[model samples]
Target: MALLIEWKSGGNRFMERCNGALEAEILACVEGIALALHWTMLPFEVETDWLTLTQMLQSREKDLSASAHLVREIRRLIDGDREISARKIHHAQNQYY
Candidate 1:
């Protein structure tokens, strides 16, 4: 839950410093989605322990928070893409933690 993002695909890895947990979570998802898009990896699910973040991304309404742009970008990437989805999981179930 402490701003951690880890991925393993063909020996590739990505990590970045973030100011807070929320930013880290958003950035992680953005990076993951972008990577999936770049690699043409469809039918993937993004799992997160933050229920609010998950709901925000799934909502159709606008987000007026400071991270609205990133949220919108996430929606755009996921919109019309039935192959992509977000799921809320328990913190204990998160593998990256």
Candidate 2:
């Protein structure tokens, strides 16, 4: 899967960068977690280090069409079986309001 970023940086920031290796690794981890959770009928949470990637996967961004495809695959695997969500945290990036 790919990564997506959504940020509100004091309404001044217009630049962004993503760590390709980290994103790929996170996506793989999410996929593995989903597969592991599939055995149980009970719903569970799927957490990731990259919250923006989660949101974008759920929202399915158009500009990042390539990434969207991978997200769609993950969504399909988890479809109707569980609920998935995204959460962002304060990292090196500017604090979001």
Candidate 3:
């Protein structure tokens, strides 16, 4: 199924079209990380319901699949930045605030 990737923080929000749920999740993460870095917000935590995505981000090895580039981009963005991390949350806990 198609997915809508969105990131909302304070008064700022971003939306983007994605082909799938995983891609959407990844893109949303990318947007969030970029924004956090832009705002100079250190010690940022990215909460996600997708366990695979969380694991992928925490992995030490490289991803060589179709979405490898996007995953790599995420790594590039957070590399050497210990202030950023991705955490897995229960699907029910991911509701709108």
Q: List the lowest-lDDT window of 10 residues for candidate 3.
A: 1-10
* Tens digit of per-residue lDDT, candidate 1, span 10-86: 33346555567887788878888888767654467778899988988788787888788889888888777457778
Worst 10 residues of 1 by lDDT: 1-10
Which pairs clash in model 2?
Answer: none
Best by TM-score: 3
Q: Best to worst by lDDT, what's the order? A: 3, 1, 2
lDDT scores of the candidates, listed in order = 0.74, 0.53, 0.77
Clashes of 2: 0
Tens-place lDDT per residue, model 2, 7-90, is: 232333232543475457355645555655555555555555576665665574463644655566667666773554545544
After the best TM-score superposition of candidate 2, give how far the Cα of residue 18 lies from its true spot, in angstroms.
Answer: 14
Say which candidate scores most in lDDT: 3
TM-score of each: 0.73, 0.51, 0.76
Q: List CA RMSD, all candidates.
A: 6.7, 11.4, 7.6
Q: Which regions of candidate 3 fall more than 4 Å away from where they truly are?
A: 1-17
Angstrom error at residue 43, model 2: 0.5
Give the better candidate number (2 or 3) by lDDT.
3
Residue 74 error, candidate 3, Å: 0.7
